[model samples]
Target: MRQLIVTEFMSLDGVIDSPGGGDHPHAGWTFKDIEMDEAAYEIKGREQEEAGALLIGRVSYDEFAPVWPKMEEFAEYNAMPKYVVSTTLTDPQWHNTTVLRSLDEVAALKRGDGAPLLVHGSANLAQNLAAAGLVDRYHLLIFPILLGGGKRLFAPQDAEKQKLKLVEHATYGNGVQMAVYDVVR
Candidate 1:
């Protein structure tokens, strides 16, 4: 079975929305203050390389589709199979893209034999998957700064108390702590 791994860049307070510059007031917060080290880059590259397929939400798909195709660095990711979970996204123009409409479809994808399915920057989708017990693992890069308000990685009101076991952890030179956790089922 393919593991559904959610990798997110979060603040100390657990905010994950718009870490890169976007409509959010606290946009570009991740890079604005701290300098990411080569270790961070290496980790991201390794995650992408290890993934058999990419699963994303509509918001993330819209943000990535236009940019990744034009960048040479993302050639491997562009070539890899992508499944975007969206109720409204009908025609995905990106290469090797499939639009999935329901949680049942995601469940089916997880049951398939493959390398881990990696998810990035899809807070809403991530929350839904976590709540539904579809997410198997979490790879969170926790930055030092705290954003007072923004969309969070885990919303307390929407999510039930799900236990996680720490698998591994590393502190990068850039003050970002990379923590890997397995969902305790």
Candidate 2:
């Protein structure tokens, strides 16, 4: 079965919102004050190299479509098959993009034979996948900053207890940490 991996650059206070886009008050916090260290992002490069397909929600797809396709750094993702989950998104403009309307479709995709599906910056979709017990893995790059209040990866009180096993972790000199976890079934 193909694993569904949700990856994100999150703050220490568990804020994943406004990492780049200006939709949130603390937008662009990912790069604004944080020093750009090549070594800190090594895992991101490696994951992009290893990912088979990309999965994202409608909002993320809209936010990334124009920029990521034109950016050279995201060339690997540009070439890979991309899946966007949305009921209203009938047509996706990005190359190799497909729209999956329901969580059931996502589950089916996970069951199909393929390389692991890497999800990036899709907060709502990621939470939904976890709630549905469809998320297989997580690749978190936790920064050393706290933005106080924002959208977090997990809810404050989750009714369903989903256990996770830490399979890999690394703390960089730039105060950035990379953690890889597999959901314990």
Candidate 3:
């Protein structure tokens, strides 16, 4: 079975929104709040090297399409297959992109042969995947700060508890931590 890995940059307070800069007042908090250190992002390079494909929601797809394809750093992702979960998206302009209609389709995708699907910064999509018990692993870079408000990687809601096993972890410069947890099934 193909694995689904959700990756994100989250605050100590669990805020995962606008980490790179956006409309949020605390936009770009990740860099502003923590000192930039190349060592802190080594996991990012490693994960991208290992990821087989990219999976994202409409909002993330929209936000990344124009930017990733243009950047040399994301060449691996640009070449790999990309899936976007959206009922409304008919045509995708990004190269090697496919539009999936629903979470059921996502589940089916997981059943098919492929490398792990790496999900990046899709808050709504990530939450839905978690609620559906579809995420297999998480690659998180938790920064040490409290961004009091914003969308979170995990939200407060009533749902069955899902067990996880910490399979890999590391701490980098500026007090950033990388934890890779696999969902215990």
Candidate 4:
């Protein structure tokens, strides 16, 4: 089975929304709260390079499409295949991206034998995948700050409890915590 990895930028308080920029109340939490050193940025770039493909939710797809394609730093990302999990988006503006219809379709694609799928900054999609037991692993970059009343990774109404085995945890010099976990069932 192909492994599904969900990657997200989260705050210590579990806020995973608007890590870059958005109209949300926590729009600039990541911008104002944390700082990334050259080493840390390089590590993040390396992580993005290792992924075979990127899976994104609609909002994330829209947000990233305009920026990543124009970014020279993300040339690798532009070259790799990108699958967007969206029911509403009929067309995607980004190059090298395709749209998947449903959760079952996503599961089918994952099981059909291909390289690992990396879900980046798509919290809603991540929650759905987590609830459906589709996510095999998680790569989280947890920053040190509390952004109260921001979007959450897994909402409280989601009663599912996912057991995860912590495989690795590394603290960067700039106070960013990186953790890798495999789903334990």
Question: Clash totals for all models, in order?
Answer: 0, 0, 0, 0
Tell me the deviation in Å of residue 92 in model 4.
Answer: 1.6
Q: Residue-wise lDDT of candidate 1 within 37-146, one digit each (tens)?
A: 77865667888789999999998999999998999988878999999999999999999999999989999999999999999899999999998899999999899998
Question: Could you tell me the lDDT of residue 25 within candidate 2?
Answer: 86
Consecutive 10-residue window with the lowest summed lDDT within model 2: 153-162
Give model 4 RMSD, 1 decimal.
1.6
The alpha-carbon RMSD values of the candidates against the true structure, listed in the order shown, are 1.1, 1.1, 1.1, 1.6
Give lDDT per model, in order: 0.90, 0.90, 0.91, 0.83
Relative to the true structure, candidate 3 has a C-alpha RMSD (angstroms) of: 1.1
TM-score of 3: 0.96
Pairs of residues at least 3 apart in sequence or in different chains that clash in candidate 1: none
Question: Given candidate 1, what's the lDDT at residue 109?
Answer: 92
Alpha-carbon runs more than 4 Å astray in model 2: none
Model 3, 78-132: lDDT tens per residue? 9999999999999899999999999999999999997889999989999999999
- Candidate 2 lDDT: 0.90
Shift of residue 117 alpha carbon in model 3, Å: 0.4
